[model samples]
Target: MKDSQPELLHLDSDEMTGYPNSPLPVLIYRQVLDTSNAEERADSFEAMFKRHGWPPAWRYHLYDFDHFHSTAHEALGIFRGQARARLGGPHGQETVLKAGDVLVLPAGVGHASVEADDDFCMVGAYPPGQEPEIERGDPAQLAAAQSRVATVALPENAPVGGPLAALWE
Candidate 1:
């Protein structure tokens, strides 16, 4: 194991590559999926994954009244708020994240915050690896736009096999 990485990584992913860029790719927005009337929308995230039969990965949602953002390799920001998105950038674009707002973020999208109320929170998931954030394209007006970045974790209970298992074999 490399001395730079967390020890748990050895037990988790097959290969943990080091990131080589700065100002990582991240996605920022307001809340989109909630439980009030957006229950189905939230469920669709899982359904979409299940229908595709993709491997499980990092998925989490916080009910913080403060702020947060998506850190997946590729994240989607949906609008759950009543208003529309204000901040506009090439990368961390803001939108009135609603219940069903489908955000199609490719790997390396960067953002800073995705705010929702304590009532319902924004949920996000991603496979292993780092999702880099793109700085807000504008520097004059929206300097307050924070850089959005989050590192995705390994899938839950991924069995040891292949290259990861071969290390021992």
Candidate 2:
């Protein structure tokens, strides 16, 4: 595992859209895990997230269509392959994610996979007691989604641990 600090990136919301992206920035932690062995890489992420209070919930690829979650924050650990994903909305920022990377997304932030390799895989998790509900970018649902997102509680621990947790505060 890498001990260096992670590179942080934030994607602010475009108010015109229904996606109520949070004030918290979209976190990107690069090479935080060892990806040489597939099974071990996955285990490390599960262990880290669970150890820090965000229990590992699923393993899969990101959705291809634009969507967001107003119910809880999400932590995704890329365990295999790589992909290009968009954030905020359809026209939002595009980024590449590879193995050993972790993405911490605040509630209501939009995300969609533009393209990914055949082997691409990720482990997703959320804060203890928090569950995710999918919300497509629909203007009609904006008000309700915003209301829910506003009331959603923050996680007590960062998924990756260390100083990176301070970004949420």
Candidate 3:
């Protein structure tokens, strides 16, 4: 968390690069904010987006509803929780509604989740390549309706032992 750390990130804009052919956005598993007050959440979310280029024009949300967050990719979480997603399948094939579940949606993949309760919070991720078309129920539905979506294309200098570690190497 040092301010002196290098903040600049460079990436190849073409698919001809050697990086993994990522079709969907990399879904990140971030914890819920411990603080109350919408301002704190807004501020924290703002910082994350700014530091990682999750544009203000992009669709992001802190949903105060009961819902499931699913898309593609997998094993990009901190906690050990049960998650189910049928690779290259249609909607309803994915499931990850637990206390600490981190699911990622890869390119060309689609998913939807069922909320256990009527309250909670969630973040979303779309596909990569030529921007993805995503769909969610309510609260986070606006992001689903966008023309295209963008996500952080695993940085080259990111730390080891992360979800994108091997790819970085």
Candidate 4:
């Protein structure tokens, strides 16, 4: 597979809610897949993640509230329809994503689905051996979640492209 330059956006911790967002920037790869077939697109995305050592990709719709993964970084490849999402945290930025759009989210980065079409679907993957633990914005779990975020290691490579040295290194 060929490499593509993706747009990068960095988000900081949400001071008001005390949500520890990721230190690593979020990557947005647009038009990664040219085909319109949702199944073909999903297959290609899964294959790409496996090649990058981030396997066990799953298919589902994103949750509708602000949440983060404490233990694993994640990648979302949109295969069907379009949706608006809030990233970083409740106070984070909002962006629209469509079919063929890919998002690479570092562990602890908050994301939620703001709105979506009926056919909206996504393929999500995590780094090998890492299972994502869902953490909603709760003050009680703030300390533990922040600690986990701080210790989560960066993935060896980017989800779609081969390596992330240029952006992640």
Candidate 5:
């Protein structure tokens, strides 16, 4: 781990469109892993997440379309390659994420991959007992989504430990 503070990003809800972004700020921990070896990098991230109570769930690319999960927060550890991702929604914020970076998204925060290298991949995990349900920005589902998001529990520890864990608190 980096032994440093992570970059914090706060995104407000997009009420007009009905995407209920979280009250918690997004956390970006940069250069926190050794991406030189793909298999080892993935193993390291999985171990770290599991050790911290967040279980490693999947290894894949970020979806190409905009979506949010109202039932659980997410922790994505970039293991290989790089990409430009949109956070919040289609018109939200754009950011670049490379291997060795860890981006933590609270429940209801919209995200999608805008562009990515062919080799880009990530390890995604969630807090114990939290399973993610995909939700596109649909106004009709807004009421139920908002209720689920509001009740989603806060994570006790960050996927990346050390100083980064304090961000969740």
Candidate 6:
């Protein structure tokens, strides 16, 4: 059976304790993959990132608390199991992500895993030559983090689409 086009979800920011949430909307692409093998699915996600000019991907689970990447945007593809995640900030929306789901988070957008199954895993990647800096809602570094986020360049293509990621444009 042919799969349908994925849906796009744009989430706005809500002010956190001392950090300024991202101004860009968080993009969610549901069921981007269908493979059941964890390793195969992760490899597929990595291939997609490479094709879209994003590289240096890694495999891991998301941190369980609210955090943001100050320097680079991130793409997370769920390869196994499922989880409920909070996006935007402390007061952001809660969303469920299952295997095959993909989430593209713009710079400085907060995300946390509220709950997850034991088998949950994800493949994460960044745009070419971009290194991610972790910011854990630190009040002292709020200004610096916000500045970095503002200056971060938007990726030329969305991780899932080489040049046709309409939601990213």
lDDT of each: 0.32, 0.85, 0.31, 0.85, 0.88, 0.78
Q: Which candidate number maximizes lDDT?
A: 5
> How close to the true structure is residue 106 of candidate 6, measured as C-alpha lDDT?
82
Where does candidate 2 clash, by residue pair?
Answer: none
Tens digits of lDDT, candidate 4, 1-169: 3238888889988767766787788899998887879999989888877888788468998889999998988999899999999998899899999989899988888999999998899999998778898887776677788899888777768888667767775
Off by over 4 Å in 6: 1-13, 162-166
On residues 1-169, what C-alpha lDDT tens digit does candidate 6 reach at each position?
Answer: 1133455556554434545567566777788888768888888888977888778467888789888888888989899999999886677789999989888888888889999998889989898767887777766777877888888888778788745345556
RMSD of 1: 14.2
Candidate 1 lDDT (Cα, whole model)? Answer: 0.32
Top TM-score model? 5
Which has the higher TM-score value, candidate number 1 or candidate number 4? 4
Model 1: ten consecutive residues of lowest lDDT = 6-15
Q: Would you estimate the TM-scores of all the predictions?
A: 0.37, 0.92, 0.37, 0.93, 0.94, 0.87
lDDT of each residue in 50-164, candidate 5, tens digit only: 9988899999999999899999999999999999999998778999999999999999999999999999999999999899998898777778888999898887678886544
Model 3 TM-score is: 0.37
What is the Cα-based TM-score of model 2?
0.92
Any runs in candidate 5 off by more than 4 Å, and if so which? 162-169
lDDT of 4: 0.85
Q: How well is each residue in 1-169 modelled by candidate 3, as lDDT tens digits? A: 2121221212221222112213433343334333444345445544443344332223232222222222222222212222333322222233443323333444323333333243333333222222332333332442442212234344322221233444323
Candidate 4 steric clashes: 0
How many collisions per candidate?
Answer: 25, 0, 11, 0, 0, 0
lDDT of 3 at 110: 34
Error of 3 at 123 (Å): 4.7
Ranking by lDDT: 5, 2, 4, 6, 1, 3
Q: Tell me, what's the RMSD of every candidate?
A: 14.2, 1.6, 11.5, 1.6, 1.6, 2.4
